[model samples]
Target: MRRDQRTGDHRHSLPAQAPGPGNLPLELTAFVGRTAELAALTAALETGRLVTVTGVGGVGKSRLAVRAAAAAAARGGAWLVELSAVRDPDLVEHAVADALRLTDHTHRTPRKVLVDHLAGREVLLVLDGFEHLVEACASLAGDLLHRCPGLRVLAAGRRPLDTGGERIFPLAPLPAPDAAALFADRAAAGLAGFVLDEGNEADVAELCRRLDGIPLAIELAAGRLRALSPAQLLSRLDDRFALLTGTRRDVPPRHQTLRTAIGWSHELCTAEERLLWARLSVFCGPFDLDAVEYICTGDGLRADDVLDVLSELLAQSVVTREEGPTGVRYRMLDTVRAYGADWLEATGDAARMRRRHRDWYMGLATWCELDWFSPRQARVAELVDVELPNLRGALEYCLTEPDETHLGQYLAGSLWFYWVGCGRLAEGRHWLDRALELDGDHDDSRLKALWVLGYVAVLQGDTAAALAALQECKDEAERTGSAIATAYAVHRTGCLALLTDDVERAETLLRSALDQYHELGELNSNVLMGQVELAMALAFRGEIADAVVLCEDVRQVCEDHGERWTLAYALYVLGFAAWTRGEPATARELVMRCLALDHAFHDLLGTVLAIELLALFTAVEGDPAEAAVLQGAASRIWPSVGLPLFGSGNFGRPHALCEARAREQLGDARYEDCLAVGARLTPDAAVSRALRASSGGKAKTRRLPLHEGRAGDGLKQGELRPGQRA
Candidate 1:
C-alpha cells in the first residue's frame, strides 16, 4: 500500500493514526539542536513585526518556532495558531481566530475579528506552518503589527511571511557538533543500552551531518537505536531509511519513520478532509479556497464543505493557507504532500481523484481564458495567480496519463491569457511542449495547443519550432473547418513571421486573421490578440503612424471591455512608438506604467520586457545608473521563466542595444561583464520559448498598424491611445 503523504506515516502504521492535535502530542524531547535559532527567534519577537522562521521540511522549523512561542509565553500569553490544518485561504483568519479562542457572533470578516482580538493584547501569536497562507498571514501580521503595537508574531514555514517589516530568519540544520550531541542525547533517553563512545563518535557525527542536522530526522534516527547498534546504525547510515525503524511503539507509529511522521497526520483526517487532501496533493504551489472548492470537492463532498474541511485541516496542522493581493490561498509541504499521496493511493482512489482534479483545473483554465477578455482582466489575473499551482498539477497529471493527454493540451492552450497578459511566456512554453508530445485526439485542443506552442517558441527565438507548430495548427484548423482555431493559428503564424523579419508574410497572415476575427462576431480576447499581432506587423514594416493608430484602437476596446492586460500591451506598444519618435520622457512614463502594472500582476516576463524598454529609455536620457538597475532587474527575472536573451530574436536587439550603450558609458570591461551576467541569467529555453512565441508575440504585435482597422474605427473615437493604455 502507498504511504500517506501528509505526515509521512509508514504504510503499516496507518491504522494507528489518531485525530486532533492532542493525539499527536508535541514531544519536547523530539526537538533538538535549535538553541541559537530559538535565541534569535526570541530576540526577533521583541522587535515586533511578523518574525518568520523559514526552512526545509524535517528541519524542525515548526518545533523550534513553537518552542519559541512557548518560551515567549513567560512574558506575554503566546497563542499557538497552527495554520497547517487550514486549507482555505478565505478561512485563514478564522483558523487563527479559532486558535486564539475568539468567537465572532456578528459574522465579521476574519481579519476584523483577528484585529479586534489582538488589538489590546500584549501577546505573541505563533502562526505555525503558514507558508501556504502567506498572503493571509501577511495581512493578519501586518494588521497585528500596526494595530497591536505590543503584539508580536512568530511564524514558521517553508518560506517567509512576506509582510512588511517581516524579519525573516532562515533556519538551517544544526551544526554537526550540536547535531551529534542531540543524537546522543535522544538515543540515551530513548534506548536503555544506547551509548556514544569515541569509536562511534565519528560515525554518529557523520550520521548527523548526513541528516543535514534536521531535528526531525535526528529524532527518527534516534528512535531506531532500539533495533540497531550505534556502530551498526552508522554503517547502515548510507541507506538511513532502511536502518531507521521501530524506535517506539507507544508514540504515533508515523513518528517512527520520517515519511510516516507526515503520513500519520494524513491517517487521522476525516473522509472528506482526506479526499480533499488527496485531490489537493496535485498542486505544485499555493492555491485559493475557491479553487479548492471547484477542483477538489464534488459528489463525495459538498463544494461549500471545502472551507470547513480546509479550516479543520489548517487547525490540525495539515493544510496551509496564505493570502495574496486578490485573496487568500493554501499550499502543502512537499513532504506532507508526499505522505498524503500515499494515503490517497492506499484508499484505491488515485485515478478517479486525479481525473476530478484534472477536470476542475481544466474548467478553471477555460473560465480564466474567457474572463481574460473582460474588463476585469486584472481581477482574472489575480484569480489565475492563486490557482496556478493546481492548474500546473492538473497539466502534469494529464501529460503523464495516457488517456488524459488531450486534457493537458487543452489546459495549456487555455492559459493563453496568463501567457499573454502576464508575460509568462517561459512557463507557458514549458506546459505547451509537454502537452504537444502527447497524442491528443481532439483536433481543436491540438490546434490550440500547437498554436500556443508556436507562440512560445517564437518568444524564445526558436524559429524552427515556432514555424512547425504554427504550420501544423494552421493545417489542422483548416482541415477541421475550425474558423476560430484557423484564425488563431494564422495570427500566431503571422506573429512568428514578424519576429523573424518576414514582413510580407506576416502582413498577409495577420490580415487574414483579422478578417476571420471580424467574421466571428462578438470575438473574444483572441480576436483582439489577433489585432495586436497585425499592429505589430505594421510597426515592424515601418508603418509607424498606422501602428500607433491601430494600437490606440485596441487600447480603447480593451479598456471599454475591462481588459487591463490588453491595455498593458497597448501601453507597451505606445512606449515603443514613443521611443521610435524620439519622445524619451513620454516613452519612459508609458513604459513605467506598463512595468508597474505587470509587476503588480506577477507578469514576470512583462515586467522584464518593460524594464528592458525602460532601461533603454533611461540610457537614452543619459542615466546609466537607472538603466543598469533596470537591466539588472530584467536579467534576474528572465532566467526564472527560461528565456534566452542574447541570441533570441525576441530580446536580441534590445539586449545588444543595452549592452552597447552600457559599454559606451561604463567601459568595455564592465559592460561585457554585465552582459555575461545577463547571458547567464537567460530563462529556461523551453518555458521561455513558449512564452515568447505565444504571449510575447501577441503583446509585440498589438503595437503594429494591422490590427487598428481603418483610421475611423471605434478605437479613434475614444482617447485611450496606446501610449497610456495601462
Candidate 2:
C-alpha cells in the first residue's frame, strides 16, 4: 500500500465536531504549534477546489485541519466528513451523504444522491482521514468538484488522494522546540504539579525526537507525567514504550492511551461495525470486500450492511483501505488488529470466528485442488498465490486447537494440489507430520495425509519413510474399503518402489493403481502419478520405446488437465529415455522444458531433478565443466528438502555416470572430494555403491539386465536394468 502523492482531490468524511461560539465547530483546542502547517492548509483551501492534508499517523494532520476548517467556517459553513468510519471503498459516497445529512432515499446511487444534494451548495466539506478510500473518494471528489462550483473539500489523511486537480499539503512532524513545548503544555494540563526543568530537558528532547515529533506520541508521552516525575519517566521510557500514555482520570477514558486514541475511533462505531472489526482481525493480510462480506459479516448481520459497517470502521480509523492488484482491499494496522483480537477473545466468539476462517480456507483449497487439473491451472496458481498466507493461518489454527486436529489433517490432505503441483513438498511434509501427531481418529483423513507424506518423502529421497507411510496407508485404505484411497496409496507405493530401482514391483503396483483409477474414473494428478511410475519402471527395464510412449501419454494428459507439476515429471522421464537412447539433443530440449516450468512454479524438487538430468545431458555431450555446474546446482537445491536425490533412482545411474566424467575432467582430487561429499549425505546403499564403483577406472556396473525376464517381470538380482525393447 505505497502512497501515490500526486493526486489529492479525494477526501474522506470527517468526524463530527461540536458546535462552538460564532456558530463554528469547536475551534481546534489548545492547538499548540503548527503555524506553518496551518498556513499551508489555509492556502490550499483558498482555491475552493480540493486540498488534502497528508502525513504519517499521529502527526496532527486531522487536528490542524479541524482548526483550519473552523477558521474557514466564517466564509462558508464548514462541515467535517470523517472517512475513517467508512471501510468499504464502494460506500465512499454514502459516507459523504451521511456526513452531509442529505435525506434523499429516492436516489439509489449514493454518488448521484450526494451530487444532487450538494450540486450548488456553498460550503466547505472537510474530508478527514481518506487514505483508505482513494478510488471512490477520487470519483466522488471529482464529481462534487465538477458539479459544485462553490464547494470546497479539505482532506486530511496519511497519504494524498490522487484525484485530478487535487492540491496536496504534506504535513511533516512538529519542530523539536514546538513539540517539546506542546508536550510540556499537555503534561502541565494533566498534572498540576508538573514542571519542565534543565535536569530532564535533554532526555525529554530525545524522547520527542524518538517519538518522531508526532503530536499524538508527544501528547501520549506527556500524559505519563501524571504518575512519575519527568526524570523518572525518562529513565523508564526504554522498558515500557507503551506506558508513555499516562493515565488521565478526568479526560474521556477513550483518550487515555495510544490504543485508546485509535479505540476512541473504534468505540464510535455502530454495533455492526464493531463486530465486523473483531472478525476481520482473523485475517493476516489485506482482504477484498467480497471476502469481508463472506467471512466477517453474516448470520446476525446483513451482508449488504457489511459495506456500511466497513465504511464506519474505515472512517473511525479502525480499518485502512488499500488498492491491490485486483481491486480495493482493507486491512487493520498490526497494533490495531492486536487490540481488536483482544476484543474478539473477550466476546466468546473466537472459536466461531476461527471455524469460519477455516471453512473459508478449506473451501478455497478444495476448489483449487479440483481446478488445478483443468485448463485454468495457471489461473488457479494465481488464486493460490493470493490466498496462501490465509491458508497457512488456517492450517496453523487447525493444528493448534485440540478439537480441530482432524480438520488440520483434512486440510493438509485437501491441499495435495498445492503440495504436489506447486512444489511445496517440504512444507507439505512438515504439516503432515504435525497433523499425524494429533493422533485423531480420522482414519480417512489420516490415510490421505499419509499418502501425501509418502509423496513428499519419495520426492525428497526418504525411501524408508515413503515406504512405511505408503504401506500403512495402503493397509488402512484396503481395510476401510476406500477405493480411492487404495488407488492413491498403491500409485504412490509404485513411485517409491521405482525410486528404489525395483522396476518389476514398481510396474506391478503402478499397473494395479492404473486399473483402479480407470475403474473409478479418477483421471487427475493421482492417476498421472501412476502413469509416471509405470513409465519409469519401463525405462528402468530398458524398454525405452515403451517408456517413451508412456511418458508421451502422461505429458498429453497433463497438458489436457493443466497439471504443470505432473507435466514436468513426465518431461523428465521423456528426456531421460531419449538420453539413454542416444538422442542427446531431444533429451536436452525436454529436460530444459521441464526445468523452465519447474523454476516458474518454484518447485524445488522438480528444479533439482531437472538440473541433475541436464547435467547428465551435458556429460553425454562431453562438456564436463557445464555438467559439474548443473550437478552443483542440483546438490545445492537438494538439501532444502532433506531428501537428496530422492525419487529419481532411474536417473541416479546416469547422474553417477556424469559425475564420474566430471571427476575425470576435474582430476582425482576434486572428484574424490565430490564423492566424499556425496558419501556423507545419507546412508543410501545404492549411492554408496555407485560412489565406490565410480572411484575405480574399471567400475563394476551393478545394473541388472532386464532381458533375463519376461515383459512384466519383477525385481531380479537386487537391481532392475533396461529390459529388451518390445
TM-score winner: 2
Provide TM-scores for the models: 0.56, 0.59
Question: Any idea what lDDT model 1 has?
Answer: 0.65
lDDT string, candidate 1, 226-299, tens digits: 65666665566554454444566674333445554344344446888888777777665787776677767666
Of candidate 2, the 10-residue stretch with the lowest lDDT total is 1-10
**Model 1 poorest 10 in a row by lDDT:** 13-22
For candidate 2, lDDT tens digit of each residue in 1-726?
121132211212333453431222553236666766677678778864888888767678778888788766633377777666445465466557546543221213456656655565567887877877887787788888898787788888877878888888888777887777777767777678655577777877887766667777576567556556666655555445455345556653223434544454454457787788788888866677877778886656788888988876665446767664455778876556766788889988877887888888888888888887777777677667566657877888888877888888989988877766665554566678788888877788889898888887776666777888888998999899999888888888887777666778989999999999899998886788678779878877778788888889988888766678778888988887766555556766787787777766666666667767665555444445545655655564464544466444555665666676677676777765654454333212222222233332223332223233223222222221354311
Quote model 1's TM-score: 0.56
